[model samples]
Target: MRLYSVIIPVYNRPDEVDELLESLTRQTYNHFEVLVVEDGSSKRCDGIVEKYTNKLRLTYFYKPNSGQGFSRNFGFEKAKGDFLVVFDSDCIIPDHYFETVEKYLDKHQLDAYGGPDRAHDSFTPTQKAISYSMTSVFTTGGIRGGKKRVGAFHPRSFNMGISKEVYQKTKGYKITRMGEDIEFSIRIIELGFKTGLIEDAYVYHKRRTSLSQFYKQLHFFGRARINISRFYPDEIKLVHMLPVVFTLGFFLMWVLPVVSPVLFFIAFTVFISFFGLIFFDAFAKEKSLQVAALSVGAAFTQLFAYGVGFLTEGWRKLVKG
Candidate 1:
């Protein structure tokens, strides 16, 4: 059995890290080691690491806060497994996490891969609604879920894996902040490494506990999309611009009523029908009428927050040039 090295870059979320560690301890695949890289987080994880030592081959290291890309690369240098996996601190591993990855790697001759994220059953209502907004096909689900994905498959850092050799050859994660994972995957592919999607191997991503936090998170994500576009123009597909366009369209439709109510009404009705489609789809997956009822807000938040970030960064870049 090939050993897996799980590299988790953590900040100050010790409680979330503790839960992730506990979930890792419960994973059926035992031939794995966990490396907890503390990225200058004031709340340390030494005690948490000690608690899980008996159950897992866990190691802890501290580094000054450079960024997540640097932290992940720092852990990659110390990993001892053939399969190197990275997870965000705010994620829970399913018991079959590694086993599923192993199954996919053993059968498929892929160089790197990523899995999707889902909200846990115990997550808060806001989390559930936000999750629906992200994964719903009508929302970002089309992109983040890896369906009709642009170009080759890119695994997100939340549940991504690459061979140790590939990490060394392609150079481990160098991009930081929001879209680093996708940027890393682009680099991996550019260096001729094949990437695939591990459909069964997913992480329970907590994302943000509230809409306010979620907005803050995605706002940066939107900016990161533009940051990435500057480096890799081909990766910036038309789909990435949809959020910005949607945001502009939404505001324009409202403002246009002053000019002509008919035009505004036409756009409003069209958007409402599209929103209803998203709600029903999210409702089926979430099985919560409350989530279904409120998913529109979540979707709007996801798109608009991201749009603001994207547009902000685009303007910044334009000014710089």
Candidate 2:
């Protein structure tokens, strides 16, 4: 069996790190090494990660407070596995996750494979909606085609794995605060590699629990998109524009309320209702007040943040140019 290197970038979440480490130790696929890249987390977390030193083939590296993309690049330099699989600290993988990934690639002769992320049992409806919305073409900014292969240049690191060949070709992730996965995937595609999606390999993601946290998450994501624009100028298109559009829609509803209240009200309702359909679908499999609230809040807050952030990004880019 070829060895797999799992690089986890962590900062300020010692508890989640412990949970992730425990989950990794339970993996049935034993031929892997774990690299915990600490992005200037507190001393407390350093102590926590140290406990796992003897338990597994784990290495901990500390860098200044760089963001996830940069931290991941740091970890990649230390990895020696034939395949590198990146996972966030908030995820819980099944025992068969790595085994499935390895087999899927070997059998299919695929160099890169990405899978759908499963929701954790604790996710509220809003978190679920946010997760689902982010996965679809609306947020992902994928090139549209009916082809079975999507996300060639729009890869998400949530549950993605790639061979060392792609890594050497792409030279790891560019240092950015947002859309690092997407940008990296774009480079991978530019370098000419085929990406395959594996439906069965799922990683359960633990989402943000509160509305405040959700908004901040989107705020950063939006700002990151702005940061990414510095590198990929044309990336300002639709998938990146959705946040801006939603923000504009909300602003216009208020700005034009007096002139055309009826039309504005109807347009707002229809727009929200369309998203509401997606929210309902998110909660169809599960039900609860917390879930319902989260579903709505997740959608609104994320779109709001993304929209606001995109404008901020655009303004900054304009000034720089």
Choose the strongest candidate by TM-score: 1
Q: Given candidate 2, what's the lDDT at residue 269?
A: 91
lDDT of 1 by residue, 1-321 (tens): 989999999988889989999999888888999999999999988888889988889899998997998899999999999989999899999999889988878899888888988989999878888888887667663767555665678788888889998988977877667688878888888899888888889889999888888899889999888888878877777878889999899889989889999998899998999888878887888888888877888888889999999999889989996
Q: What is the lDDT of candidate 2?
A: 0.74
Number of the top lDDT candidate: 1
- Where does candidate 1 clash, by residue pair? none
lDDT of 2 by residue, 1-321 (tens): 889998998888888888878877787888999999889877436777788888779988888988888888888789999988888888888778888887777788777767777667666565665665554443444332213433343446867788899988888887645778878876777777887777778887776756788677778778877776777777666556777887888888876678888888897897778667655655564465455445566667777987887788678878987
* Collision count of model 1: 0
Query: Could you tell me the TM-score of candidate 1?
Result: 0.97
Worst 10 residues of 1 by lDDT: 141-150
Q: Distance (Å) between predicted and true CA of 4, model 1?
A: 0.4
Which portions of model 2 miss their true places by more than 4 Å? 123-153
